[model samples]
Target: MTTSAILMYVDVWIVLCFYGYLLKIKKRIGFQLGMNISIVMGGMAALLSGVLLITQFPFHFTVITMISTVAGLTVGAVFGLLFDYQTFVTGLTNGIIIGLMSPMIGTVIERPTMFIIFLHGFFIFSLLTIFHSIKRS
Candidate 1:
């Protein structure tokens, strides 16, 4: 598969993971953390958008990637603030991290890089979440 295709899949999975993690820990975090998440997401989204524009990648690729990152971050943040500020921020933060990191990692692997990233992230964050919970308790 092409790099763009792999990146697209990576993006989708990243969003999924972002939501998954948020659902797991939203109630445990606070407003400050949520605000921080929003700021990080916005910054990452702007950076990614700038890179996309400067690099002049294919039109669809740029549009899809940017939209996914920006829209997901914005909507997630809004939803989090509306329903649960913590959840929104957590989701947006994770989404930004995944969105930004996936493309770079995808470029390194020849094939099946998306799967590797997904598994790697799942395991790492799963452990982190568990650790955070344990620490809190």
Candidate 2:
């Protein structure tokens, strides 16, 4: 795997582990917070997967879109399952829409490296936000 792809995969692992942590305390999470968590996780996962996969395999937009969509749906569904059905559906639908659209954004970008770095930073920020929110609840 390329360095960027490796990093994205590592990110996926980190996010999954975070989901595991959330699963342990699912009861403490309210539906609104659950909805937010699912949306953030799903959208970010789709965006990252789409952009990185497109960068790595630029010639295969169709396949990459499918892959990214699945990634988003999976991540969203996993997180949403900890809460409720409404959260699950919301995440799933958001993932579908974002995953479909993200590859085009990837193609239009002038600087993939910088964008990816910023995205990862944003992902970290999102995680910290969720963690703090969880702590507050």
Winning model by TM-score = 2
Model 1 pairs in collision:
80-88
Which candidate's lDDT is highest? 2
The models' CA-based lDDT, in order, is 0.50, 0.90
Which portions of model 2 show Cα errors greater than 4 Å?
Answer: none
Tens-digit per-residue lDDT, 23-123, candidate 2: 78999999999999999999999999999989888999999999999989888887878899999998998888889988988888999999989888998
Candidate 2's C-alpha lDDT? 0.90
Q: Quote the positional error of residue 118 for candidate 2 in Å.
A: 0.7
User: How would you encode candidate 1's per-residue C-alpha lDDT over 34-107 as one tens digit per residue?
Assistant: 55444444433433332333233433444545554665467446535633656666757755655554444333
Off by over 4 Å in 1: 49-79, 82-137
Q: Against the hidden reference, what TM-scores do the models get?
A: 0.43, 0.97
